[model samples]
Target: MNTIFLLNKTKDPTLSEWYERKINDELRALGIKDVHCKAVSSEPMALEITHPLVLICSSSILRDTYSYQSAEQVYAPHAKILAIIVHEKVKFFRHRFTNLQFSPLRFIYNPHRMPLRELIFHLLSQLDIDLEVRR
Candidate 1:
């Protein structure tokens, strides 16, 4: 079974809900039947989950130093973590990339501007997962 954890720390409930529903829908479309995915608001709750995980978290959640460290400690070395930062231009994220310490990490800037399939493919690629849907 594959586990995908979406740590939504965004204050906007609407955006968080969209991410959860869209991501899960795409997973289902790809025939990931044994996949377990969830959107969690709390860091401690996410940390307690024991599985080889793929984590997608908003940068707003990690803006606080403690929150970022907690995330690094929890998901580092075990999961493929993707940090999303909303910006006007995707290139802006490059300036901030040096600060992160986590390995197996990827970045998604201005996710709203990207196609859902593209985003899903990027996440699956990071985990080296190939999905085949039987429609």
Candidate 2:
């Protein structure tokens, strides 16, 4: 199943993209080529366009992407959401909102601090799709 990774442009776009590329590579390792790390700017599109099996995003982007509404309207009924938050965003977010809808990754803080492999493992273990391609 496809995985949607909603990402923002960090202070260093180049470095951020490089890291994103690596994340994508990990997704590839899981045989998920349909992964996407989209910015919040491009929205209002059908959330089911990809019909992703999982949704991942940083906490800082929660409001910026209009994510609450977007996810409510777009995310598939069965898809799980993984919220990757930064250290500063953690305290408030953990208890701030109790979402019964999706299962978040719940890292200590900072999306980057969470290992891409661990993230993939989480998704794979949960989704458990028989990959069509093995590479």
Model 1's alpha-carbon lDDT is: 0.54
Candidate number of the best lDDT: 1
lDDT of 1 by residue, 67-126 (tens): 445445645434436554342233334555433433334344365455666666656665
Model 2 spans > 4 angstroms off: 1-20, 28-41, 46-50, 53-109, 130-135
Which lDDT value does model 2 have at 111?
Answer: 48
* Residue lDDT tens for model 2, 31-123: 676554433332344233444323333445444344434343434333334433232234355544423222232322244344556655554
Alpha-carbon deviation at 112 in model 1, angstroms: 3.4
Alpha-carbon shift of residue 16 in model 1 (angstroms): 3.1
Off by over 4 Å in 1: 50-80, 83-105, 132-135
Report the number of the highest-TM-score candidate: 1
